[model samples]
Target chain A: MLTTIVILLYICVVLFDFLPSKETRSTKERVIYCILLTVSFCVLILYSLDIKVPGPTEPIRNVIETLFKPSK
Target chain B: MQKEMISARQMFCIIIMFIFGSSVIMGVSSGAAQDSWMSLLLAAVFTVPMLLIYARIIKLFPEKNLFEIIEMLFGKIAGNIIIILMVWYSLHLCALVLRNFSEYIQIVSMPETPQLPIMIAMILVVVYMAKSGIETMGKWSIAMLSAVFLVVIITILFSLNKMDFTNILPFMENDFKSIAAGAFRLYAFPFAETVLFLCLADAMKKKDSPRKLYLYALLFSTVVLLLVILRNLFMMGPGMVGASYFASYVAVKLIDVADFFARIEGFISMNFILAGIIKITVCLMAAAKGTARLFGINNYRKLLLPVSLLAVALSAIVYKNVMEMIDFLRFYTYYAVPFQVIIPLTVWIAAEIRMHKRKLA
Candidate 1:
């Protein structure tokens, strides 16, 4: 159910926002837009499927801890 | 294309609302407990030098945004690398705030509902605001800031009866190190987060002074935040304020005037929504602009939807639950230092050197 909703939202975004401005956009603009949208779509689908996606929080925490351990 | 410009007043209003963003609801500098007000003050003092540096960056390059300044100063390859890092920071900050709001709503108002839909709803509004451009955001901030201030004042006045003024006794009980730590956290999270303002500095008119604008906004926000801390401390006491995640909301929940007027915690939620929208919109705009710069695109608006969708996805999976969300705050101060301090300071020095050389030429 969540996956379906994610798909629908992406479709709306691409159809309404992305496609309508194709002519005015340069080739580079179109390519970058599609790339970003595709990445977002994949991530949303993974999240919807209850699949665990690795986040940056742990790595960031680990790096910070390594660099500067808190006194408190 | 014509540049979008915001008046000094609008810029001031936007900065205050941005500072009040999640800090109002999250209750900043809580590590200092009853002495959190001191921590807040210390944080404001520490932020001044950095704010001056940020202001000077804008003064050096009058009309260009941070990304443009970076590209001009460092040239394409290295500049693009820095822009990507900044884009990540902006997107990450946006996701963090989004997660904060979703967690608050789910825990306080809707326990049964999932956070993804709530995040989506919030991000949609934020995306629309970002797409409307900074001028619209400035106008919106002016209108909503008044409501936020009124709600805060009303809450403080109504809770006066319940406040235990003694809860703030034993000044400096936390020791200097602890207070400094708390101040550092406060500075990194909300105060230094104003670094994002440089991304929107392009919108300020040529006549406006960036240094005065930044200093005034910082002063006003520090006062408001101090009042909020005192109100929360006096109302909830140190013990409850320390224990509760949403200290402001929990503190406001205790307000009871003649039993006729009660349960006005919703006002805190309203404040959160108003302020949080501006925060998220600003972050989203920064990220979209950064991404557009990365790809050499002229219209940042075209990237807003994709950027916002990515932020929503990240916010969804950012943490397993609210505990992890709160836990991240402990590590956030350290994680933020490089972005908040190191980078801007570097840019300022380089900008100053370049300006000196150009004058010599």
Candidate 2:
């Protein structure tokens, strides 16, 4: 899935950032890294966005449900 | 000049806040209830000496991280085995705790989302924090701890009208036998896991008195967690509290001060942001630090990505379903006790023996 690819990309960036370098990196490199991290997290959130939960349709039913529902 | 990393004081606060917030909203509130509050108290009392042992280890080797200490104390082969086990434990604990909260969100909020995406997003933030290093974790935790403390106090104030002390009633209804059983199992989990702080102690900026930090963190976590647990028990009642998966979230949802300002668990979830990130960051840090020491690398950050992906893969593979995950915790409570409590105690004794001999010499 697209989500999987995004996560893979994120992992790459995170691991690369961990490498200890002899010289300070260019700002461009840092920006690209940040961009990549943000994009992947965004993709992840959107992918999860479709997780719709059904709310109570009727108030009376909701009250009744709460009263009777067993502990989860 | 470079910014100083976290001090032992700040690290102590970070560990306490993160651990208290951890799974507190998920499992602890559900199982302990009024009795859960008792569990927190029990955990504190039991962990006090364990904390002292940890302090002794730190005091003896103020400059050495745990992996190196093990290497020094036990020699390379035996030390490597202990390090590997600790790494596995930290990784699995991170995954386990992540799943614990993800399951909570599934139960109470987004029911249709797969657990992986939720967990991955979380791991990313933690990876970022871990990459940044320990000082960030400390500052973030303080900001978070303050916010969560306020929310908890406000929730208690609003819910005072609803609390029924008699709910924890008949104190020993199950008797000391049952209480002790719960204590023996739950004690090491969120409480004694503080042993992981051994890694953090080495990173402290100024000298820290491990005894003071341990006692303060233990006392503070116990008090706040007990309040939250007691609130859940009185607010939800014993039977409901015992059975519910996340009694604290449910309790927070029920907070209706004047019937308009409500659902403060949302604010607390922001705090969850810090705790979740800290949990994973600390786990990764421990694993990386252990790896670096074992391989004798100069640094740990290089291992972060490989380890994160591995953790993600392993987390996905760890349990078949949320039920399996839940069952893991139930079983793991008993399984983790000896390792969390007993192994550390054994190591402490060994360390002590070595220390005494060193002193005599």
Candidate 3:
């Protein structure tokens, strides 16, 4: 049910927000927009399904830890 | 594209609100315990030179934002690499703050609801604000900052009865290392976060002094944050404050005026929302601007929705839970050093060199 809602919301966003302004955007703008939208859409759907999409926090934490180990 | 301009006063208000963003509710530098007040002061003092550098950068490049300045300074390949780092930083910061907002609401008020809905609602509002551009954001900050100040004053006044003066006794018990660590955390998270304002510096009128605007805002925010830290420390004491996740909210919850006025912790929530919106909007605008500059787009507004969507998704998965979020704060100071200090220092040096060369010519 949550997954369905997520899909519907993105659809509404694309239809209402993107489609209306499609004509004004340059080709590069459209391509970048679609790329961002698609990536976020996939991540949101995966999240809703409890699929555990990888986030940047873990790698960032690891890198910080490696560089600056906590003093016990 | 037409340039957006905000008065110096509006920029000051925006900076204050942005500094108060998540730090006020999260209770900055709690690692220093009762000496957090000292840590806060130390953080403000340490931030002064960095703030001056940021102001100088803005003065050097009056009409260009950070993205344009980077591209101009570094050229295509190197500048784009730096721009990508900055865009990631801005986007990640936006997501982190958004996650902080949702987590606070979920744990404090609405435990049953999932975080995605809260994040979505916030991103929508933030996107609208970003789409409106800096002028609207500046005006909004001016109006909302007054309400934020009123709430802070009211909460402080109401909670005065419960505040025990001795709670901060035996001050400076912690060693310099501990206090310095806490100060670094406070400086990285909130004080230096003002670096984001440089991304929007193009909006400030040429007549307004960036140095004056930044210093005034930093002074005002530091004082306000100090008062808030004192209030929390006096009410909750050092141990409880360190143990609690949301110290300000917990501190405000203890407010009782003859049993008639109580449970006004909602005021902290109000403060967070007002300030957090401006903070998120600023970050989103910066990220959108960076993305547009990367793709050679004229208007950043066209990318707001997509960037906002990505932010929402990222915020949803930023951490597994609030504990991880809080734990991340420890490492955040180090992670932020590159973007907050190193990059700006390099930019300032390069800019100085370029200016000197031009003068010689």
Candidate 4:
């Protein structure tokens, strides 16, 4: 139910907030906007479904741990 | 809209508030524990040179932002790649700040409230402020900074009775290596994060010196951070501070001056809200502008809504829980070094070489 509401809200945002300015935007801007919106929509859906989305900071954390091991 | 310009004072206030953003609530340089105040001082000193490089880059380029300057120095293809990286950095940083605020709110107040709605509401405010443009942001910063200062001073005064100055004994217990690392972490997280302001360098009024602006802001934030660290140390002591996720909030909780004036930790939340909004708005504006630049779009406002939504989504998924958030913060200094230090230093060098070539020609 939560996922459905979120999806509907996203569609409304894409149709209203994002689509109205499409005529004024260049092809590049429109493509970038669509890509970003799609990615965000997917992430939100995954979030609402209780799926674990991998954080971007994991790689950095691994590298830091390797370089600077905590002293006991 | 004509190019919006902010006065030097407004820029100063924005920089101070940005540095204070989440750091004030979470505590700074915690690796040194009792010595974190010293770590903050060293971090502030280290940041001066980085600020100088940033100022020099802006002064040399006159009115170009970091993205424009990157393109001018690295050529179109390489510059666009770097620009994308910078935009990603800004967006990711915005998400991290958003996550910090959401987690903080979840922990302190509204334990039962879902994180998603809180994050969405915060991002909406940030989007609205970003769409209003830099001029309004500068004005808001001035007002917010003053209010934050007053609250901080009052909180400190009230908490003085509970503080124990002797709690900071055995100052250098953490070896020199750890202390130095702590200083570096402090420098990168809050100090070097000022690199984002490079994107807004062109927004300053023509008469203002970017050098003075950077120096003044650094000094102001440094002093504010130093006082905050000292206050936390005096109140919570080293062991309590190092153990807690939000040391400053914990310290603020100790401020029970009298029966009539208790539960003043709400003021800390207010401070966080004011500073957090400014920080997120600035990052959102930078990300949107960088995206617009990437796509050759004339107006950045067109990209704000989508970029902000992406930021909110990223914030929701940034960490599994508050524990992961704390763990990531331990390594944030290392993660941010390349974007915060390496790129700006390289740009400064490139700008110097280019200026020399033009002078010769």
* Per-residue lDDT of candidate 3, residues A21-61 (tens digit): 89988888899999999999999999999998888889998
CA lDDT scores, all candidates in order: 0.91, 0.67, 0.91, 0.87
Clashing pairs in 4: none
Q: What is the lDDT of residue B265 in candidate 1?
A: 97
Best by DockQ: 1
TM-score of chain A of each: 0.92, 0.37, 0.87, 0.80
- i-RMSD values for every candidate model: 1.4, 13.9, 1.6, 2.1
Residue-level error in angstroms, candidate 1, position B147: 0.5
- Model 1 misplacement above 4 A: none
Question: For every model shown, what is its TM-score relative to the native structure?
Answer: 0.99, 0.82, 0.99, 0.96
What overall lDDT, based on C-alpha atoms, would model 2 receive against the true structure? Answer: 0.67
Write candidate 2's Cα lDDT for B298-334 as tens digits: 5566556556655665555455556666544445555
Per-residue accuracy of model 3 over B1-361 as CA lDDT, tens digit each: 8989999989999999999999889987549999999999999999999999999999998977888899999999999998999899999999999999999999999999988888888889998888888999999999999999898899999989999999998988999999988888899999998888878888989999999999999999999999999999999999999988889999999999998999999989999999999999999999999999999998989999999999988998889999999999988888889899988888889899999999999
Residue B203, candidate 3: C-alpha displacement in angstroms: 0.8
- Model 4 TM: 0.96
**What DockQ does each candidate score versus the true complex, computed on alpha carbons?**
0.76, 0.05, 0.71, 0.63
Each candidate's fnat: 0.79, 0.02, 0.70, 0.70
Q: Candidate 2 chain B: worst 10 consecutive residues by lDDT? A: B26-35
Candidate 2: chain B TM-score equals 0.93
